[model samples]
Target: MTARHVLLLTAAAYASDPDGPWVDGGLVLRAAARAGLGPSALDAAERAGLERSPDGRLRLPGRRAVYEAAHPARRRAAHRLLAEAALGERLRPAGLLHRALAAPYPDSALGTELAAAARLPGPSHGERATALAHAAGLAADPEVRAGRFVAAADQARLAGRPHRARELLGRIDELTPTDAVRGAAALVRGLLALRDGPMADARASLLLAARLCPGERALDARLAAAEAAWALGDALAYQEAVAGQLSGAATARAFGLGMAAALDDRYAAGRVTLRRVVADAAGAGAPDALLRAGAAALVAGDVEAACRLGSRALAAARALDARPELPRALELLAYGELRAGRHARARTHAEEGLRAARAAGQRNVLAHQHAILALVASLDSDADTVARHAAAAQDIAARHGLVQAATLAQWALARADLARGRAAEAAARLGPLVRPGPRQGHFAVRMLAVPCFVEAAVSAGDLGAARAAVAEFNVWADRGYDPQAGALLARCQALLSAGDPVRADARFTEALARHERAGGDFERARTAELHGEWLRRARRPARARVLLRDALVAFERCGASVWAVRTAAELRATGDAPSHPEAPGRLSELTPQQLRIAHCVADGATNREVASRLSVSPRTVDHHLRNVFAQLGVRSRVELARLVDRAEATRAL
Candidate 1:
């Protein structure tokens, strides 16, 4: 069928029945637009008030007019015209009649006609007979009601209402003789078993359904069997069972398979398949599909894509008044922003999502949101706040058996401890997280673990262990899974510990670059402190003092009190402490050169451009900037920029 025809039919279906078989109207519109539908068609639809609802359900004011205009008979002709317009199909009365017969209807003749019109080559003849019998209220034919119950159960399951599906299936089973309907009962029982987490029973029941029914009735039964096999850790069996099942073509089933692959660490395969599902969903404008796609993007490290998809999902959910899915979309958006280094945006969305989840009594969502907040707090160097949020997340996860979330919370707690300089405590706290190897998405946890181990090794002066940890981290980094600024910073520290000043300086510079790229001002400040210490050890005391001072100022500005104090102590030891004791707290104490450099950097001008604007040679600008860096004790130009990005961000609070 033409894309336009598909979209029109989809729209008509949604308009005729808001709660219908097809759940995503937005996807259909997108597909139609992509297929080169003129703006006039969309504008006409819009004028008809079809696009007002975000969920894509039509809301036409003149329903009678719409019904008269798009009657089934007329629709059949329109479909023929559309096929000719888009597919170059030749008109045939038999074809038109066949298509018309396939259309869904309340009566047997219409249903039969539509089926014949659509050329649906299935044992639907039996289904049609059963439907006719049931509609005639034939008392002797028990299979008629059984067919109706099965159809209703299938619809409920497709709509994500598993409980309703189970209820209907139960009624169907009770109404039929046990021996006669054993296969149908087994299929329904299998689906219910899967939902209730009894994979073994689900697998057995579905196996029986596949054996007894062996045809159309076994489609869902086989898929359920595969899912149960997957859940039971029988990967080969699951893959074999779902390889050619009808349900395997479904988006939800594909998404489930992708998730299973991801859990198995087959990221490349998972990413490709998930992205396909996402693309299809996006094309169809499916909110749930968009939400799933956003999650997949996150797993693939496409934070920007995740953010966009997640926002779209949130809007779709809100339009549909789907309160349950709103927080999920919002949380995904918040995490995407956080990963993309949009801290203020992340914080705002996270807070909103948290409030919504809490209000809805969604403890699992609340816990995940809390964990995200804790990560943000850690980035801001709010150790106490991070600890509190992490503790709360841990408690919630533990109470609810959220093992994956609990692991992340534990990692966050370790981060808080490390921020407070309690390396030993952090290492101890993170031990379980590392040993368990994660039940889901272990990359983030593994990233955090390496830093904790390195921190403990460094604090105890175990250079060998530190080196080993850095090597292990390098493996992950090489594979492009590095999760934090600390990984690069740790590498720099290891280089410094190994007494390779040249490479250590180079690594430190790289770490500074990474921090700047990530917009991690706090880490940038810490990098500057390390660089300053390196310079001091190399007897470049003059330069060391300059970077150290900048680092201290930036740290204090970012609310990193511990690092600020440490940088200040380093400055004093180098005999290059600020001339004014209160200078760190007072912005005006900064020299003109420092202020000028800060302002230019914050404006995102390159150093050479800053030089041109300030009427200085690039070298002179670099020298002065280096002096500014030393005087302010900052690491890179990016950190300087972040320090001066906003008054509040840089202010000593």
Candidate 2:
């Protein structure tokens, strides 16, 4: 055969089921050989770089253009040859699947066999059979096709393939399915919408699912409806959705009630309910139930339990290959790590979760991960990274009506402003978010940002506004809603009392005492810096130097570079430099993405190679490389390589 024929035959093997990410190399060769192409077809395609993917799987490198370019008659012949080869006495499931896929028309006999195969219990069988059923146009028998498609859609949704799930559901819609089958498909669609949303559409689909679905699925739909209502910021609707879950004993429903109570500020009741929910979910060993309880634990201020539950949920999800739940588990873990002041671990989890969320098409989860990454950047005082991540998050949140994600992104932006000494701007940006009005942010999130707002208002000389915010924060602190609440509240009070030296001195002392008990290094350092600055202004240089030195050390430990520079300046003003100031890492100034790109480029990889490795567009790699060059002050790839080598060598010291 000619080279063109070899390529077309190989392309036809993959085009037969183009939805999958990869086709087995052996399967491709066998199918092509059966199509009158020699076994040398694989060798020729490999030589042409058509099988150039590092995984050795058969897929068109740049879209399916090569397969689409083939003549229609040739493609059908190739599929028929594969189907003919699959007809054996003791047929394996894989061979049987090929036969079903090559059906010339909507053969009801072939449809029945594939539908039965789909109903067989296995991890991948259902998805494969249903995809083949639809791709082969097997909807002539509605009874066989409808049930199979509905189950496949649910499996796709659970596996975190939202687009695939929707495609299957759309196929089901073309058939005359029974009410139950249609309701089942709607349930999966609603769940998919909740993950990749327009909250309004998710709520509508879920309500329909609840009305038409039966038993457990109805309960599941109602529970998801409650979450969608909460995300939309409709308090009345949230309550109604929660009321609908009252009749169910599902562990997820218990989790929903606990989350609602916590959001309502009944932390004690919420914690109690969530504790039982966690135990029940653990006994049931359901990944989804574990995620619901884990999220509730985070909201209840039980960070330790939340982390534990998150770890368990992640393990279970991976073991069962539950793709949709994986990102949710990671989000819970990242949030817990952030609350506990494990900034490095939090950033790691957020980055991994961001990638998984992208793959799963979980838009809401992606927004949440972006917001978390922004918060991590804020702690590092990296304003540009903060702005970039926050912008990405807010863009998604606005489109999806995700109040919590939007609130978190706004808080990150305001915090970045404060770090850059734009106190007035920060205060202006955060005031409406913290205060109650139509433009106010989510209740739980806005409350967490109150300390930042108070600090900004105080810095901008708006003492009256600062005082009111501090008073409200004091109530939350009294309730013990956060482990670091006492320290943050004391710091806020000290800021408001700065004009009264004696009162301010007392509050500063109280803040430092509370800081000794708090977990967050960055927050503790901020309090110390404020106290030291006040002492220096009071002409108490001796005491100021001591506090300033400690603050500088704490800031450096937490990688808060901006805060470290300011604290170092304060220490010098008090006649003391940061006495053992450690030398910074050579690549310390680079953002995570820039660092990755620089390392890749330094390793002698071309831009295209780096882009493929990172699963990003070449243009994105080029854009980040420009910023990396500017930041590192390297004029060419050669200088960048030298700089990276020296940095690596210095780290070895």
Candidate 3:
């Protein structure tokens, strides 16, 4: 038999009528003739494949491969023909479907293409199949139209036209509203809001989408909601989003979950998630993971690990030419430097990141940059710069609802007030953040500011407040809020709750060691200064000299002139030769950091050696080394060393 006859026979065999007898040979030949096959021609066709069994029943030879030989289009046509031909004669469709498919579809390029297809008048089988396929495409149900629009919107977004994507999403409502369409629409809106502005809007839209989304798309919608909640600074929402297990061990899923954990300040949990992402990662988003994991490491107090990951992130971003990631990488690098007391290098990184973020129109990064700059200025005792940058950062962070950025900027201003002896006012300024009510503060930021608030409160004679802050800090310490927190807590305890000189001294000593272990030079310096002050008041000026000298050197290394001058006064009161009141020469012109780098180079320390002592990168050491040479009008390390020594000796004389 011909191919059509074989298909007819196959369909007839599989689709038996419950109310009718098996189709015998005579009936098959009659149906074929009615289907336009001539009787003599059908008899002349090959019948080798359609052999009969001993019982006289047709048993066509079939194989799995033979079954796949026919195209789906042909199978569908034969099946439709059998449904009609089995009942009686074929009932041809009126021209309505044909005219609809052939007509110009409003705003549809697809209909135009279908119209171009030949609508032949003759009864050829292929032409009939083609016409039916065209009509079927035009008559697709509303659910199919919604899915098509969702797919088109995704493509438009990938093509960098989010407005076009939103427009296509709007077309979904015009067709029909299925759970799938509404869920997809909400998911896209959430993702877009995440990138465009405040995350509150994104979180709300994503929550509804995750709840209503059905089927395989459910996991994706949940991921979107979790990320939106993280961006909106809600840790609880992130917790719930990852509660439902992911569908697979997908690297993207790991990355999303890992980022949520990190933003929620669950660093240990985030690290676990990041490790999973790394194991499953195919190098697609590994660089992004590196950046986020590095920040988490910094917060966890792993200084060396943070530096290692930061260096890798910077290199990867540059290698991939991932301009969008550059600002974040640079921002993290600056934070690492700031934590390590590498103020000069931190300033460079923050300034560079600010320019990159502004050019990229990343306002979130811009707000963080200004906050970092504010802190840097506060450290440098540049009150005017600190005030200006802090105000700018405050405005941006508040307007954008950035909890962390705003908190950091507020902390910077409070630190400045504390430096200027306005301890009472500083205590008032930080009290709200240090003891936040309900869900009002960022965990990491509050963790960082608590120690400072305790010192401020104690200095302002609010002993009860100081003790309460200390208790709160102990709670954070138990949860492993910060790596350097132990040392800071000890120092606070020594100042606020210690009963004897011996206990206070022991606590101070422990805090100093912890600061060194954590590689926080500025913190160590401040601790030494406080301990020296305590010793001086106890009539042990000689014992105070050693810690006072160390504090002076550390303050100089961090470019903390305001604190350094105070240390100098404390040193002078200890009967030590203090820094010259008006130190003459180029030494005064150089920054405290530059002066310290010069001292290290003058003592013949290598770049790596200096970097180890200063808790900074060798590259940072080299950069500061070069600056020291240029600023002092020297040609080499030798000249830079000689010039610095000569200037110092002259100032003393």
Q: Output the lDDT of residue 40, model 2.
A: 66
Give candidate 2's TM-score: 0.78
Candidate 1 C-alpha lDDT tens digits along 1-653: 24234435444333212333332344335435554665566566665455446656444444345545555765554433332332112212123332333344434544343323222332222222222223322223466556555554544443334455666566565465444366766786676555443457778888788767745556656666865675444556665655553443477667656645654457568767767766666664556568877876765555677889988988987775455567778888987887665656777888998887765445667777888788777655435577777888777665544444566667766766665457777766655444423343233455545655565556656666566556656655543332444446554464445477777777777777677665655656766887797788788899899889788777766655545645655665676523323233333557787678667755544455667788887677667777777766677644554344334233533
**What is candidate 3's lDDT per residue for 1-653, written digit by digit as tens?**
36445544443333231111232344345446556776454444334345444554444445223435656555444444443443311212212222342234532444333323323332222223333334324535666556556654553443334565567677677776687668877887766555445667777777777777764466666766665565455667766876756663365566556656665557568767665554443243556667756754664455556666766787787776455567777888887787667877788889998887775556767778888888887776435677788888778666666677778788888887776567898898888888858644566678788888988998899988788878978977765636678899999988974468788999999999888876677888989998998899888998899999899788877787656655666775676642433223767787877778778766545566578888998788878877877776676553454455555556667
Better of 2 and 3 by lDDT: 2
lDDT of residue 643 for candidate 2: 66
Whole-model lDDT values for every prediction: 0.58, 0.74, 0.64
Candidate 2 residue lDDT tens string, 171-224: 866678888887787788888988888888999888788888888778888888
Clashes of each: 26, 0, 0
Better of 2 and 3 by TM-score: 2
Model 2 poorest ten-residue lDDT run: 577-586
Among all windows of 10 consecutive residues in model 1, the one with the lowest summed lDDT is: 85-94
In terms of TM-score, the best-performing candidate is: 2
List candidate 2 stretches off by more than 4 Å: 1-17, 25-94, 123-126, 129-136, 141-147, 172-178, 244-249, 279-286, 315-319, 499-503, 577-653
Error of 2 at 398 (Å): 2.1
